[model samples]
Target: MIGLKPPAIDRIALLAAHCDDIAIGAGGSLLTLCSARPGLRVDALVLSGGGTEREEEEHAALTAFCPGADLRLTVLKMPDGRLPANWDEAKAAVEDLRARTDPDLLFAPHPGDAHQDHRGLAKLVPTAFRDHQVLGYEIVKWDGDLGRPSAYQPLTPEVAEAKVALLQQHYPSQRQRPWYDREAFLGLARIRGIECHSRYAEAFHTNKLTLDLAGG
Candidate 1:
């Protein structure tokens, strides 16, 4: 009998510390995949939520963003800003999910992110899901989290438009931030696209990547 084979990377896990992180980091990719392929399953997990009202919005936003991905969102209710302080509980929460689901790919915030909670979630993802293909997504943080991204995912005009539309339309609370505007969205994509020969793209920083030189 074959020993436990590494799980297929078709199942994707999106982890975040807050309600909108999943949408902000990977909403476009999620939207495109679920629409194009029925085999892929995108699971979204958030450690904390703003409140019942905010959670209601999360549900609505995710539904709009990821139309086909239902029964995939899991809200863990951990303390948002205090994930590092509550390391044990936070680890356990992620560990429990990892045990049940050996996904093909996992997306979380990059560790170098400026926000403490984002960085904490980024670090925690590896501890729980070792051996899986993990990708760290970068969000525009006011504390100068922007970097020269080494990786890029080109976004369709539709995907880029959907991303901005969903964020502006679905997440009202986030709009209050000065940096949360069309410029920030277009600017990020513009810069990353420059790296990958596209007009728009989303950037991510991955710690581990295996290149197939023959394929290229």
Candidate 2:
């Protein structure tokens, strides 16, 4: 596979329908990015889990995931699994985030995600940040919504293991879920790594991209 290095990414935005969604989808990438760029600005928005223990979990999880970065996270009070019904509120929150930061890149749920909440947020992303590059991260779930992703961020074995360990460590609230085991997370990463010629990797899908082959 031909490789393409991303331009200088000093800042990034992360959007999610629920609290753990960002960590589950792109925790390894966050680890790699923040480590490479010390004090990188990471602005995160979550539609639900505010004013609850889940929000606390999200805060701690993301801080661990993004080490030594300027991490600012917002967890809204929107109802979980009800984003479609609250379209206006969701759109406004996304717009509010766009107005706050002109990030170099964005990580959001994909349009084809089976969950209505994920799909709703995905649709709202482009409406606000039209010019930014958005990488749609995937969360492995029982819905079987995982698709062939075109972009891959290969992870070192240490980072891969650290991702799983951190997930288990910080999110005590999610430990009850059957699919929330280390095996499930590692298994998906292993498969993605195979596709990208790495020992471990996090994959993402993108709807549009503008190439600068001339190095302008």
Candidate 3:
């Protein structure tokens, strides 16, 4: 399971149906992990977002986001907004990634997301990484898909700012979206931070959680 412990968890997989899911979800933790751990391996997979200038921005954005990590990015050419129409190809892509990495931890979109692409990726992840710990991260949106979160990751003010800055600087194509403002990012973090008594935080939800309360 994903936790604070170190046990061959150097390899992580960030899988999503679109380009920015990785950035939107675990971008801060990724920045923290790569900078802190030398030679950390991160494999980023996007079921779509290829063959376009956006992909180039995504590549540059991710490289800056995961500094010091041995990052590998793959952008699948599946059609966006039509994930259900391409189930076989999408599932196969996830299985291909799973076979190659057998990742220790996986960051994927929360299934409850209103976007079909995000929901499809969320469902496909568990089937491939059956043994790996999967953390479902939220993408603050106007679709009212934000749900009650059960886990918290405390973010320093610096980390919080960095997350917003990277999003704003890199993904200019999305700037016009009503939900793409810094307020949405910072505001959600502030709300979740309140949940965990931190200055700011990112929240996650999981279907299966392993707790070692016996140690406490």
Candidate 4:
């Protein structure tokens, strides 16, 4: 497999419907990205859990995840699990984020996600970031909606461990969830690693991408 290195990504955008979704889905890749690029600009937005302890947790978690990057995060107070009913508000928030940054890469929830809030926000991503490389991240849940992801970002064993550590350390609010454990996080990464031929990995689904083979 011929790997293609992306042209210098100085800026990135991350979107999620809830707190911890970005960390649970793509924390290792983020660790790898920010650690390698030092001072990269990361703009993150979450549709719910605003103005609460979860928002505080998200701020800390994303700061830890992005390391030395310039991180700007917006957490909206939209009611959770009710994105369909608040379509205008969600769309407006996403559009507002789009207007603020021209990022090189985007991490967002996949449209096929079983969670209504996640799926709703995913559908709005394309409408706003039409020209960007949007990688749809996955969150493992009881719905068993983890389909075959089309892309993979291989992670070093150390970075993978760090991701899990950061997750465990930063978000105490979600500690009660049955699925939130070291084994579950690392197990999924290991499976994704096998798929991508690495020791550990974070996977993503891409709805579209334009190749620039000639440039290489």
The residue-level lDDT of candidate 4 at 215 comes to 90
Clash count list over all predictions: 1, 0, 0, 0
lDDT of each: 0.77, 0.96, 0.83, 0.95
Query: What's the best-to-worst order under lDDT?
Result: 2, 4, 3, 1
Model 4 weakest 10-residue run by lDDT: 1-10
Q: Which residue pairs in model 2 clash with each other?
A: none
Error of 3 at 164 (Å): 0.6
Q: Report the error of model 1 at residue 27, Å.
A: 1.7
Name the top TM-score candidate: 2
Model 2 residue 3 CA deviation (Å) reads 1.1
Report the lDDT tens digits of candidate 2 across residue range 1-216.
999898899999999999889999999999999999999999999999999999999999999999999999999999988998899999999999999999999999999999999999999999999999999999999999999999999999999999999999989999999999999999999999999999999999998999999999
After TM-score superposition, the amount by which residue 199's alpha carbon in candidate 3 deviates from its true location, in angstroms, is: 0.9
TM-scores of all candidate predictions against the true structure: 0.88, 0.99, 0.93, 0.98
How far off is residue 103 in model 1, in Å?
A: 1.2
Candidate 2 backbone clash number:
0
lDDT of 4 by residue, 33-64 (tens): 99999989999999999999999999999999
lDDT of 2 at 212: 94
Q: Residue-wise lDDT of candidate 1 within 1-216, one digit each (tens)?
A: 111222333677888888888787777767776676555766777788745566777878888876665437777667768888988877887898897787777878888988988888788888888887776888877688777656666788888888898989988977898988878887887788787888888877877866554654
Give the backbone clash total of model 1: 1
Task: Quote the lDDT for 160 in model 2.
Answer: 95
- The per-residue C-alpha lDDT of model 4 at residue 128 equals 98
